[model samples]
Target: MYAIPDSRLPLPQVLDRFPAGVPHRRNHVNDYLLVPREVDYFNGFLALLGRAQPPLQTDQLATAARNLNDVAAGDTPSPCIQQRIQHAHLLEQLLQDRDWEPSADISRELKLVVAYLHASRQLIPDTVPGVGHLDLAIVIDTAWPKLAAEVANFVDYQRLRHLEAERQGRSDDAIAFNRSSWLELREIEARLHEHQRRVREGSYAPEPFTYFRVH
Candidate 1:
């Protein structure tokens, strides 16, 4: 497991501290979408680590965090609640099934939940009170945690693979190849982060969810 030295450090500072070209990867399909509750859990986990990284990039991470948590806890459910509950159930089932072990990564599982939430936003009608204009902050608030988790997991997996190869006495050439692949993944992650940053800045808008929107 990768060690986080100080969770109190802000996310931007953490990103700045890491080398510019470290590799990262997208999460597996099943674990891509995260529900609001899961987002709260993740942020709390970050707080426990002593670093404060919020999924959304707005200056007010704490407020954003609380708002999402509130949404999850409130009695009147968000329009996407049913879908999220269903997705969560499916995930729980998959996680419980031992036959699915080889295909599972806890990080990926979490990411799929994030992806589902992103997709779920579309389930709300354009006529819905708060969702009509689909704000970028809302999108980022929903998407960033999964993206971050995927990148982190990619790094962790590569590190473990490299160590395993070294222990197995793999040829130096093979090890070099793995390292190169890992570096490429890092580059991909950097691009993803940049892309997400742009999306947050309204440089790009997500494609409309044809199937998700309630007509």
Candidate 2:
């Protein structure tokens, strides 16, 4: 398993710092559900996904937890919630891309998170009056570090492939190479550009052989 740093897991931070102040106080039921309770429950759902066996009778609490946590957390002050949710769509696209090979753990995590994003009734249902996507935002924020590198690399691969396709007058899908091939192509292009630069510089002769010039 790839070693993810502890900081990438938001649970610890949420546990340590939340329920401590205005926005996340335990008495503030909406805020409480959105911050720690729902997030904690969602983490449990992720655990369930990793298991091979079907959920046990006792595992039914996850369902109950989801239902109990079904809350309409009123408006979030954070403006980034919409943008963050949109970014989740990008992760969804990355998950769907057959050519990209994320690590097994990452792939599984993405599948589960993306499944939650698509679910009709999430911790805060998408149709809720406000803060519908806040839970998703929290989940994605937690998982972002894990997904960030793969998403960036996939995006770069797509860009280079698209440019190559345009040069060849073909569709992006017509390119038959994968990430490794793209890296090789990028390296070759870099080397070729460096060689061209050296050639250009070599064309310019020094002002003169100073020793040979009259003093």
Score every model by TM-score.
0.23, 0.63
- What is the lDDT of every predicted structure here? 0.39, 0.58
User: How many steric clashes between backbone atoms does each model show?
Assistant: 22, 0
Kindly list the per-residue Cα lDDT of model 1 for residues 1-215, writing each as its tens digit.
Answer: 34322221122232213334643232211122324554455444444323343442222333322333344434333333333343344444334433223133344535444454445444223332322212222333243344445434444544545565687788423654343455565677689999999878784566766777557
Per-residue CA lDDT of model 2 for 78-158, tens digit only, reads 344555676688788778777767667678778877888888646656554344565576567656757777767777778
Candidate maximizing lDDT: 2
Model 1 TM-score, 2 decimals: 0.23
lDDT for 46 (candidate 1) = 40
Whole-model lDDT, candidate 2?
A: 0.58
